[model samples]
Target chain A: MNFPSKLIEDAVNEISRLPGIGKKTALRLALHLLKQKESVSESLSQAILKMRTEVKYCAVCHNISDAEICGICASNKRDRSIICVVEEIPDVLAIENTAQYNGLYHVLGGVISPMHGVGPDELKIASLMKRIEEADAGVKEVILALPATMEGDTTSFYVTRLLSARGVKVSTIARGIPIGGELEYTDEVTLGRSILTRVNYSAE
Target chain B: MNFPSKLIEDAVNEISRLPGIGKKTALRLALHLLKQKESVSESLSQAILKMRTEVKYCAVCHNISDAEICGICASNKRDRSIICVVEEIPDVLAIENTAQYNGLYHVLGGVISPMHGVGPDELKIASLMKRIEEADAGVKEVILALPATMEGDTTSFYVTRLLSARGVKVSTIARGIPIGGELEYTDEVTLGRSILTRVNYSAE
Candidate 1:
């Protein structure tokens, strides 16, 4: 579509470059921004630039942070003996939202994917191993909370194999039918695996 | 959700302030930006800031432009005698995409909505009247191509009533089932209107 103004076109083009946003959605968003107060756009621009330029990775976990060490890694409330390994910072947020696990996290940044030319060496795996190998770090168990994709499985296998040799207990999040999922709609592979891994249930 | 960094949190907050975007999507977009090259975020920031600060509106039609008058209004090829009135710039784009219309456009910026405290005075309706009153404008027809909602109808009624006194023909775009729309799935009102406004068919 021919834009009436070059400014609108430029904004739309930049916005559509984002993942999942199309040209039409970008146009809608650009118009929405135009309709808002000037301060909204100003703050949005400032926030994004500031985040991108000044953001740092945690020295220990490699998660995005403001300082060398992340809040979770610095906190005394979290268990230092258990480390939850994740693919990205969003995973850390998702797990933190549950309020179930009170452990430190090691963000791998991405999983090992040969198709994308991302190998174990390209990730923060070396840092994770260094953290685990520290004599005084007190880490005993590592939890792999990566996705259920093939790349996630490959990364998990590689990490667990290395950790097991060092006498560290390694585990992964359970995979099966979701808690509220109906059996009829569940995929065959997940349904079959869920049944095979079923635990003894005792009704109260 | 709790963010690992303050910068990420601020960016997410500002992004989520946009219409239709929630906290989760904002977080995802923020992380996506974080993973991209710094130039991507920088250009996006600069584009939004420049557009919001330097964008200009056409003096005659009130459409967004980089000059005093928009290209459509200034062009000699367009039909200056006919004006297609719309609610926003996007509507102008939608009509332009069809490449069927050859007339100029008048963007009202917004529709009349009493609940939202938007009145006729709040829009660019006065400038539209000013354009029609100009001796050299030679406007013979005014098409109300606003949405089919109650607010659109009210605005159209208000504009047509004023324009009728000035001896200008007032019309609206045809309302019926869309092209390629399945008859069985069409809504009752639209289907009924389609039947009522059905034209005579001739077979060659």
Candidate 2:
């Protein structure tokens, strides 16, 4: 496919590598970027470069943050006694969008998947346990808001066992979500129900 | 909605400005960009920044080109006398993808749209007429592959009148495409038929 320029082609290739974007859509996106005002593209480039440079995981919650601790972790009004365990920073955002859960969050960064070679150690599980044990507020409940995937279940099981031995109440979201659909695609109502009807997990 | 970082927010906003993208999709795209290798993002950034510098409109054909003339206009073997006029560079790429049309092309840049305040002066109509009048190859047929929209029809009518006055045979693509549908989305077979069965428009 003879592109107008090598630069256009390179941008398209990079964009196509993204989730859900194809080559044609990537080309369209690249063209759209090119047609935009110089400042718009410049800001976008600068943003990506800056994100790569300055963004880091919160030492407390493991969520992407610009500071040592995320805004959620720093907030004194939030329920310090409760911690919501989620897969990624986006999941934390999803929960926060509801303005429903006032509890703090512990972003696992990823789920435990033997197939993908991601184990419990690969995630921020140890930090979560340490947060529960040594927490100044003495955490009472740990809510599992991970996706209802096989890997998600595995990670949840591992966390529940670790937390139960330490005598912390560990629970998971209800089975209201569809079997295979991702948590990101689920509507707020269903997600809210899944969170509201959460059940305790018996450590094995 | 309270993004973790200003940089991430900027990237999301920039991606959301594209044709069909929304805020949610933009965030996903931005996150995807963040996950990519540094070199990939750098290449994408440089490509976007270098668009105007690397690509220029062909001086003769108005098609996007790296050199003074596009590949079609520069090619010695192509039928220089038969100029197929289209609305944009994407149309040129669509036609070339078929490997059927061996004729040179003239890109109008856009069609006449009085509602949107676009007119002949805004398009490359004058240059097209100049190309025909300054015919080094003794040009014969001028194919109008402009869209089948109202504005496209008006542009085709305007071009046909100007060409017919100079004793040139002007033709338009057949009416198989649905109204308001773009030529870019049309199937190759349907587009090919439209090209093959083009009708002569003798200005009354």
Candidate 3:
């Protein structure tokens, strides 16, 4: 599609490079930006540039941060004896949003997907092992909170095998029907897994 | 949702401010940007900023342009006798894409909508009249190609009334069922209009 201005064409092209955004949507977004206050565009541009160039990953957990170590790793309130491993930064955010986990996080950056050319060496597996095996780290438990996919399971199994050799305790989050999920609509594998891992009922 | 870092949160907030984008989508975009090369974010940010700050409106037609006069208006090949009036800049691009019209265009910027606090004065209506009334301009015919909405109709009627007083020929694009549209699924209003405006079929 032709744009009335070169600047608009350039903007639309760059915007459409992003995932899920097409040329039409990019054009619409560019037009909307044109109609808004200059400060709006200024802030948006500045924020994106600053985030891309300056954002740091925590030295210990590999989570996004502004300093050497992330807030979760730095906070004394968090359980340093436990580290929940995940695939990406968004996973850390999702688990944090639940407010149910008080342990630290170790972002693997990505799972071991041979199809995608991502191997164990491409992730933070070595850094994770280093943190857990530290003589003074006192890491008692390592939780695998990854995706419910073949790649996630493969990564988990690999990590579990390595951790078990080092005499470190490893656990996984339960896979079952989600909270408020109807049993009728639940997949058979998940339903069967839920039944196999059933816990004693407690009214209190 | 909570962000791992202030920078990520700021970037997400700015991105979410765009139309049709929510916090979750914004987060996804921010994360995607983080994973991409720094050059990608730099180009996206720079393009948006440049487009917003530097884009110009044509002096005569009011379409988005890089110079005071748009390329269409500056060109000698385009017919100056007729003008196709549209509601916004994108409409000009849409018509240009069709390659059916070779005449110049007058972008109204928007239609009259009292509910949105947009009056005739808010658009380029006055500039359009100025261009048409110019003695040496030699503009003879004006085509109303606004939207099919009430505000579009109101603007069209108002422009036609004004142009008629000056003895200028005014016409409107036909409204009917679209090309390749199935008759069975056509809406009642459009099907009725298509039948009413049916023209004699010409083999030549």
TM-score of each: 0.93, 0.84, 0.96
Summarize candidate 2's per-residue lDDT along A1-204 as a digit string, tens digits. Answer: 777556667777777887898998887777676666777777777766677666777899978787888777888889899999999878987888878899999989899998988988899999898888889869999999988778888888899999999999998766778789899999997789788877568853
Better of 1 and 2 by TM-score: 1
Q: Which ten residues in a row have the lowest lDDT in candidate 1 chain A?
A: A195-204
Between prediction 1 and prediction 3, the one with superior DockQ is 3
lDDT of 2 by residue, B100-176 (tens): 78898989989999889999999999998888889887898999999978899899999999999999999876666
Of 2 and 3, which scores higher on DockQ? Answer: 3
DockQ of each candidate's interface versus the true one? Answer: 0.87, 0.50, 0.90
Candidate 2 wrong stretches, greater than 4 Å: A177-204, B177-204
**10 residues in a row with least lDDT, candidate 1 chain B:** B195-204
lDDT of 3 by residue, B1-204 (tens): 888899999999999999999999999999899999999999999999999999998999999999999999989999999999999888999999998999999999999999999998999989999998883768889999999999999999999999999898999999987889899999999899889888878953
Any runs in candidate 1 off by more than 4 Å, and if so which?
A200-204, B200-204
Q: Across residues A100-179, which tens digit of lDDT does each residue of candidate 1 receive?
A: 99989999989999999999999999988899888386788999999999999999999999899889999899999888
Interface RMSD for candidates 1 onward, in order: 0.6, 1.9, 0.6
Q: Considering summed lDDT, which 10 consecutive residues are worst modelled in model 3 chain A? A: A131-140
How well does model 3 score by local distance difference test? 0.93
By lDDT, highest first, what's the ranking?
3, 1, 2
> A1-204 in candidate 3: lDDT tens per residue?
877789999999999999999999999999999999999999999999999999998999999999999899999898889999999988998999999999999999999999999999999999999998783768889999989899999999999999999988999998988999999999999999999988768953
